[model samples]
Target: MKGLLYLSLIILIATILPLVGCNGSSEEVFKGYQLPPEREEGTTVELVIHETYTDEEHQVFQTIVDMFNEDNPDITVKVERIPKGAQWSRLTQALATKETPDIARVEMEYIATLADRGTILPMELFWAEDHKETLVEGAILSNTYNKRVWGIPDQIYTSALFYNVRLLEESGSDIPDSNWSWEDLMQLARKVSDRNPDVIGLSYGSSLWELSPYMGSYGATIYNSENKRIEIDSPEVVKALNLLYGYQLDVEGWTGSPIQSFINKDAAMVILDSNSIPKIEDSGIRFGVTKLPHGPAGSVSNIDGTSMVIFKDTEHPREAYEFLKFLTSSKIQALWADELGQLPVNKDSFKNVDVNKHPYLEIFMEQVSNVIPKPALPNYSQMEELFNMEMQKVFKGEKRLEHVLMDITSELNGETQKD
Candidate 1:
């Protein structure tokens, strides 16, 4: 009986050893795609990354990872794709369960939240002193909170005013340009709407993010981060909101769904970001892109992007940091620019781009100089939700603009205290 049991145990070990060797020596497969060989003989350090990228983008990313893996034979990187819409929820749950990946691609807005939770490693600890200078303006600032950068920005882009060329010409309106002011935009939009009542003059939203540029132009900011207080109920904010409200009220602007309205030709002009360009082009809209009309604060728009962050509890910190650096390298940025039309975060990559090949980027490049970084506050999203809710009430005529602003100011200030 003892001899028979020993032989069975020997057979089990023989089967398991081969499976372990196969797993360590063979190529890694994920999501039905095979990756480069992950050798068996080294102290294999595996770094997992959670990211949201389209299938084509993932292929490009996989190729990039293969290059990195070839250069560093001891390290193997694995990407876990998360649906774009569910990224935040999935990441939060992972953090709570302590099952988070070594690295993650996070939106700029979530940097503060993750950093404040002490779940993300600060970039300042691993990065060189002058490294921040290599990125484009506001790139590092977007991920900065509490005087430290929590992530390395991988993408940066801002919005511009998109006008229907045919509508502008048919209405006999002067072509809009970079130097155009808010008043100039309003006048043009009104003229176009009057010329054709079927079309609204503008397509926009009342959300704090959308209203931020106009608010800044009017010399009002949503929050005073330095003072740790809300500043959204000021006279300047009211003035800005009232001007936008006037446009909507007077012209019956299509604020319900601005992008859709622009697609349907119901809106003569729309404020949109780079992501909207492909859709607009596909819809066959004869459009032109220009800077958002200058506000009192100049022609500033909201600047934000996706950034790479290392989880604080990651076992492979050095490898993760190295991978973060690789992702932000000029070569990688240029590849993203060429393949995905992503606005490069690296200043060197931006300088080397062929603007003639990507003409829309030329307009974005012009606007990049004039952008306001979103406030890096832990409760920013919560504040944004409350502000948007109040603003919607004003838009629906359920409350006056001044009353709503005052209420939001109080409510958001209370939220800040809780934070």
Candidate 2:
């Protein structure tokens, strides 16, 4: 009986020893080797993002990713840089493949198209009421279409009046106040140019995007999205076009890249967006930025921005939303706006930013609150090109203002009806 008991005890000991070692000995082995600390135990998720950003923006964006990864050890965010003009094409192709990125940075204008194609998930799926309240209403509205929110706005911007201080002083004109009208702007322009014929009073582009604020101030609209028609030939639009063309024809100035002209000191006053601030600062030009001059509709500007959208087919929708939320958080939004010279989409971000240091941001924020966004139509680009061509006819003296306006209105109306 003792011999049998000893054999049984030996067998039991042998069986239990390997099990104990399997449970704890490996940990001990790693501890003895001073292995790096174990990673947080979770299913690691890899999220691929497709984005198009300038070199400077790319650097800042990478830092944002790194910060996020530090906080979320289980999630690895990978960004693929798409060329500036190739985002849409690459995105469409990716959608056809199994390797579609989890997130894509799309322009405000492309949001509607992506939503229409059902390529992106509706924001309602992930956004809560509390989250909705944190964003700027105008920014949220720009991302909404068909009564559904489609994208999370990341960056917003609008144009503001930029004036050269020395030029204004030499022209004997007082700095324009917020309540100044088109007439006031005209007077300022005239005074500045009259003082020096070599320097143009104002410099601005004639593209539809550039002209949006001008048209809005005069109570003109290129497309009536609610009514689904073109209103470019309205009396207000014609008046606005005539007045602007007259400025260029009667006033002394050039009509190309506004920022370039301003940097070259070829113009005393220029209509430019916030992005132009750094270039102007680099040029060492003493400048002041203010709201655009008022018109029949009061001070007006057009809002636009880049947004992030999640693919409908993304395997990790929850993780992707976390990132979008992260991007739009007050802290991140404020940091992005401060570094990129962009307007923040999160209203709460203002608390962290010092507008005194970035005075132009204040003007931009004010403009964004009450500005008209570009119509969120899939074919907006097509209409923009057509309007550009027709408007050029008036500015180039190739066609009468009234005639060009009539033709553009008819053409755009036809396109609207086709939709």
Candidate 3:
């Protein structure tokens, strides 16, 4: 009986050992090497933005985010708006410290520098992979850098000539049409100027961004592309400056106050972007918008507004790309444009919407159709600073127009050479 029991135990051990060592030709070892399944939803993406507008505008942005989240339950977005006047510097610091958010709102002028520094991701890869075609041509070109697309334009604002319709009618001067020349505008301004001692003829913003288009339309390039030189000293630029300065000084009651002065009804006409339309409408003043006064070369206007860009350091690049794509969609763009009083970049949004329905908006949209984007170079901000300082000197009557421009051109050329 003992021998039989021992034999059974040995058989049991042999059976288990063979199963554990199963490298035999009849069976295969179970080596665990497959990846775990992906999560049902994507991670939350963080966005850094600026509180540049009113609380209502911020609420609209929140509404858009809420709608996006409702449609995509698996993904979420968190927006953090930096304090006013500090967004650009703060964002730059974040990039330097490698602490950038997943996405950010950027001005068109700043996009080139951020892209050149590799702080923002190129959207070209996502655009190609998704095969999306909602973006307009002007927007695509504006957000691109060195042949690589960097962002999606969420909004666009272009400058137009806003005049008091009543003032124009009373002055016996007709508002210039799209084909009107600079000389025609000057004459109208002079006529309008003689109307009231308290009303200035025209006003433009103090920033160089607002002044560059007029210079460009005179067939003058601020910076020479090939030689990397500043060319504001050219005869055309001096002539353009002289014209602008003449309006501020020679025209009766012409005060050199900024564009806001015109909105306060202190000036007969003002050069402004679409952003100011809502304010102008709320002021209870009747106004008419027309294409910018033409210069020697032709009519040209500068484009302004914010764009949505994905940071290169974002944890969820694909998700960020998707959100940007949705933001620029025609439907969403039209809704935002209509509500916010911004001109929609989509040409289709204008259909069925009478330009006269919203008197100022109609004019703004019309002006947008003819705009030319400014030079989107990496050094644009630096160039703008120099240009503004020199222009201020000229405006203050402290320096000759030719001397101020030539000095600035030389200084800018020197800076570019060091680059």
| TM-score list, all predictions | 0.84, 0.83, 0.78
Please identify model 1 stretches exceeding 4 Å from their true place. 1-44, 415-419
lDDT of 2 by residue, 1-419 (tens): 11111254334333322211121322222233222233456779889998888999999899999999999988989999999788878877887785678999889888766765566777776777877899888667777666567788877777889989888888787998788998888878887888888888888776788888888888876656566566778888778767788887887354757788888888888888777778888999998988999998998887787889887777787788888888888899898888877788888887777787787788887777667666665555666666666566567776677766665555444432231
Q: Score each candidate by Cα lDDT.
A: 0.75, 0.75, 0.65
lDDT for position 384 in model 2: 66
The local lDDT score (0 to 100) that residue 290 gets in candidate 1 is 87
Clashing residue pairs in all predictions, respectively, total 0, 0, 0
Shift in Å, residue 188, candidate 2: 1.7
Model 3 CA deviation exceeding 4 Å by range: 1-53, 128-140, 195-198, 223-229, 246-249, 252-254, 352-357, 415-419
Residue range 218-259, candidate 1, lDDT tens digits: 777655656656678888888888888888778766376789
Residues forming the 10-long window of minimal summed lDDT in candidate 1: 20-29
Q: What residue pairs clash in candidate 2, if any at all?
A: none
TM-score of 2: 0.83
lDDT of 1: 0.75
Winner by TM-score between candidate 3 and candidate 1:
1
